[model samples]
Target: MQYYKKDKDKLVCLLCSYYCKLKTNQIGICGVNKNTGDKIECLVYGHISALNIDPIEKKPLYHFLPKSKSLSLGTVGCNFKCPFCQNYGISQEKNIDKSKYYSPKDIVNIALQYNCDSISYTYNEPTIFYPYAKDIAIEAKKHGIKNVYVSNGFESKEVIDDMVGIIDAVNIDLKCFNDKYYKKELGGNLNQVLENLKHFKKNGIWLEITTLIVPTKNDTYEELEKIAKFIKDELDIYTPWHLSSFHPDYKDLDLPRTSLETLKMAKKIGEDNGLKYVYIGNVPYENSTFCPNCNEVIIKRNRFEVLQNSIKNQHCPKCLYKIQGVYPKMKTIRKTGFAGSFYPQEKEEILKYIDEFNKQITINGSFDTRAMIVPHAGYVYSGFTANIAYNICKDKKPKRVIVIGPSHSMYYEGASIALYDEYETPFGNINIDKEYSNNLKDKYNFLSFDDNMHLEHSTETQAPFIKHYFANTQIVEIVYGKMPFEDLSSLIDEVLEDKENLLLISTDLSHFYTQEEANKLDNICLNAIEKKDMSLFDNGCEACGKLGVKALIYSAIKKDMKTKVLHYCTSFNKTKDASKVVGYTSALIGY
Candidate 1:
């Protein structure tokens, strides 16, 4: 009960829910608030824990102007102790013994010099470092740089009330809606976080939310729907809800990685609930916003690099749709693709895989896959199938490639593009012209370059082959999971018309069926794809990305292209097991 005030002899610790009243020399639940000599001065007011220049999207903001650079600042100390704390290393660390200290004056100068539009208080709870954040925010405001706060959103109404004038935008990470999960797992209350979100919105601060979709923990469809519906109803459909992919890090190691499928489901839940802007982060996707009305691609992106932007004066060029965010000048493809596979991940080992895969594909020719159909699963299983597909398409050195795939790895909206300017594939750097991607988003409603797709392997797996063949080219990436076939075809046919635009479909066939049954099931979808018959294909086709396949089929037919299957095999053929098997296929689509 460390609680003390400056007035006479009374003291109160209002740092957390467990408010402890004290006389002198007592502490509160978070252990930082102390009763000291009848005066309550924040002990770690000037202590900054972490700082960096991060993309605004990394904060999981969709509407706060994409690609805006943020000056991120964080300080140690948090009010709650959650079990699945991603930043536990710093949040629970009492490492005041180490690290250099900087004053508020120093921070103001540094933030100004960094050319940041705003200062984001992130990484750890800014509420615990309230005094310092507030001080820096005040100073930053004088320089015309606004303040942005990224928090767990569990602070009191009073704490949120104080941030009113200073914080221009806030990214609130809502852990859960259930009180049991809040109390047992997060060591907080649900009502508190919800109240703060409404408070930020009511107070007229730009608000965003991020929810890490962890495996077997908070990834229920019901929970996702609830969260999405609440945001749509209370915060308005335009409030961007970032569904981030979760890895087994910190203390949550037993949990498997969040499947891209789960992330897709979450996005669907958001859209189903009428959320206008939804995105997936920490996983790769082609999030180029398209006009929800017209299938015209408003924004063209490959990872972080923006390629083709048709958004003019915030209105769609094709459908006259009003756009959002800062629309920068269009970017050109510098060099794209060149992704390698294999990894326990030493840079050298990863590079070697690319080299080997390239060598195998290069024996054929140089027109390699401008776009490819590769497997996203680990190389040991589907490497040969994915490799052969690349080999067949290695003749065309198209400059821009669009790798489309079903999201088995993370949740995302319409399609998400990785924000990385260049993706590496041992072969070389393939520029993902970020400016062009942003322009694409400006022109479309459903498209955006979300950070979530950067490390997504499905599209990345195809890069090595494209790089091995093209070797020195720039490319773009497009990632999507669920949508109508017509929408996919409409978008692809529009952007990928140039022969230089290589289009790839990375998908595995059937999953978890016996080898024989899988082959039988996958062939049905494959036939439909080859015949360019979208209507014949059913959702039960069970192919990971049948939608993308069917969309490609329609696009190919529209162009009168032929479908060439370079390789088709089951997981059983690639492995010793024949029982529980998946399927793989690599096809060269051509005119």
Candidate 2:
């Protein structure tokens, strides 16, 4: 609410550190706040650019509101100019679209509609639109909803003072400890952010800190030690620190990604300095909470979901030591969405269907199946074909399976990896190989935990089959939207280096057509895969996962692996309706 003072026909704005004195029709450094005649007005007061329901852990807040969802909202402009900003498309741009306007009442209503426990101001700099967020926070408190700020921690004293009673928690980005990097690379002052850290803790707000550790920029052991020391000495040692991996994005495309070893080193340093809790973000790791006294695992985490927790009533069950963070009062379960919709949900019926399909599969001499290419559709049409390939691979007794498919619902840049601890099926939950999944993401900048992977049928459809055959083996699911063929092939080769790892590619050949037309189109794709011919992909293959198939073929040819076609069929076989049908096929790749 602190705005302007008129002095000799000029307006002086004191909202942030950059107290700009503006003439008529002049804007501040934030680009969204401007002076109009007598007062400073925010151009994006009621406008919203992005909104969604996100897990509180995804905001990297480990110490506050664990295992809950928040209604997140963001406007258009930002004050700082960080080159490696992830949300630069909306944060750095000044083109405001007024069509998507939501008042304070509307925001609180949307939060209640989504069953969210809190409202988060994130994605862009929340300080720029502080007026709008303040109103929403006040209204949300009336409805028993908390307010959070995912900010850069560069606010002025007036702003933090105003948020004393309203803002319940904050996850601030302590980008780096070097003043030169903040001045030259981020257009910010390091001292200001450090001062805000002490202010936030002094005001008794739940404070958590995050640092995006870029590779050669701020990932040195010495620099990391200073950051850890400051948090332990200046702020309380109980403050949770989140060390996130940086992917090359926006204006910094040539920089290398942060490695897993670096994150591990930072975590060790934070612990050595007496910090209670430290977590690695963006890439998966053993990111769980432990009791500081007894070293017992209090809470188990797999990406954004909390798998298992032993913290009872905010105290460790083993040692009876008190834990620092908030714990959920009730148990939570992640349900299966594709069970009743795509196939049978009953266990006996599902086992009967798999048994019937297995009876039709003819497995010859034991083939060491390292990888497989299968189809994903309704069971009546594609189940028999998929069963043939799964039967062959099941003989190998692989310890872990990696499933890759194409995305149909959302568009993302790289491949999306599933972050859930266990995938649900009619039989039971299948354990996920979290260590291998984290290594893949840490080694390649093109892999991330995208929410779209949760809604994708291409990967989820294969869960029941894998669970039925490889009951004890772990699984890793990946979905690609748009990625380079060579990049995926490279990742495949890396994964296949371990002979115990099995790769499965899911796709359906040729959409709706006559039986004759379906076979003609399906045969071309099958022949190309069989012959290891990359050029055959250009001959109208019509496979929905042509990119993944091509990548599999390319990697197989490079590794000198053999390909075998197990079976091929169509939906016409089940319905006896030849007018419109979909093609399905199965194949295997091994030594």
Candidate 3:
């Protein structure tokens, strides 16, 4: 209804450069847009075919929000018919009506629920679904979340005008420089893409360019240099140009995969043409960002993972040279998603329980209190067990506390690090050690930002206890899923090397079992933790946070830290329900 006009007896689509003229019931070049006797109908308006949470680097956007997570979205349609399209299954699919619908509000909520820094319209030509994308972008901007467009540079001037403030960043594919080659091979005009690239820059949108070097098609020296020079002259020299390799897919099966040498050559040409940040993708290369002035490695990356980023305050530490492009803003607050359900939602009530529990516990003599294993359940059921560890460690206060737990809701590989500035709790707000969290993420490849996994009660249940005891110390949360013991243990050992840091591992043992049976299963866990024997855990030592607990045990053994069981109980102790009881325990690991 927005970008269409009635021309005589046909409808003209003004959303793209083609300005497609269609009769009644005729579809545009993009298969999803059709003229239905009255107006242009977007067939895939609410239909989303693919939704994924990916690193910002996976968008091949090196300069935008480095080390942040983006919610990627794709629909089933395209404006071009490139034979060598990497995502042709979705881009070229004809039956797009089968996908489920998610409203614009649904998408915005999903992005927020996952703690995404941005929403990326990727994997296909986003112009084909501009109506859906525009609505989502408008909603996303209201929440301080940015929008990205990974396009083929065919959006009409009218669409660009409409998206001037809504779209924040774009990674447009410049394909090639030759007009004849573009028309014959990609069904697009090269000049149109060139003009749109200039328009995006003129409109103040953060711009990056990509060129999938398809073997002999766009890998020649002449074409690569021309494309590189245009970026320097038309767009600014600071615009990042990504030279990616192409593989044989869909109808382009005869061509060989783009060679590493060709990609390197393109990178050299871009550098020679005065481009500041030229990166090679789809290959094994040191795709790191260097300071243009001093040539120091400011940001080190391994493929999609950032290994180390030394850009302090968005400037190079060595020379204080200011880097270009968008960086992450660490001001998010982890909302209390499970406050009233898992724990108290009022500060007064939480403090009353804390005071009552403190009156019943005393610190054992000279226990160093380096780390703890505490139960995560409602305060009424396991508060005494969990309170024992917190009470013991209250005097030996550390500068920071790292809370590790298992994710019970979402399933994802590796671990999710909470990058928020503050974590919410009924006791009060605790400042998250964002600098330390970023350092760990930079040091390891397995840690990433996946905010949706943080909503689990496994970690949220510990926030109130942390805020109550460690009132001044900062907090860092790590929620793991499908991670190996060695990986997590290695991280634990690293954290313990700093004597001023406290580690809190949250877990609950043996669910919904009879009290008699739970004691047998829970004792095994208690013994294994006390003895620092990982072998005993495999013999039915059940725990919802087994991975975190096991990693702590392994780290304690490696560090020669002794474990002491402070308190142990079952839900039956409070509810008198022996038939279906849950086990809870608390322990301290120290010298």
Return the top candidate by TM-score.
3
All models: lDDT?
0.70, 0.86, 0.89
Winner by TM-score between candidate 3 and candidate 1:
3
Higher-ranked by TM-score: 1 or 2: 2
lDDT of 3 by residue, 308-422 (tens): 9988878899999999988866568988888777677888888888888889877758688788999989988888889888887877667789999988888889999898888
- lDDT: worst 10-residue window of model 3: 92-101
Residue 476 displacement (Å), model 1: 45
Q: In candidate 1, which residue ranges exceed 4 Å CA deviation?
A: 1-10, 14-23, 290-591
Give per-residue CA lDDT, model 1, range 539-574, as digits (tens). Answer: 446777777877778777887777666667776765
Q: What is residue 443's positional error in candidate 3, in angstroms?
A: 47
lDDT of 2 by residue, 1-591 (tens): 566678787887756666678888998888888989878898999998899999898897876777888999999888889889999988998989998779899999899788798899999999888888999999887555789999988777788888998998999999998999998888668999999899999998889999999988899999999999999999978999999999999988999999999999999999999999999989978899999999888888998898877777888899999887655444322357677766787888777878999777667876677889999987877888888888777666667889999998877898988766677788788777766778888888999987646677788788888888888678888999888989999999987788988899999999888999999998999999999988888886888888899999999999999999888999999999998998888999988
Ranking by lDDT: 3, 2, 1
lDDT of 3: 0.89
> Which segments of model 2 are wrong by more than 4 Å?
6-8, 326-591
Model 3, which residues run further than 4 Å from truth? Answer: 330-591
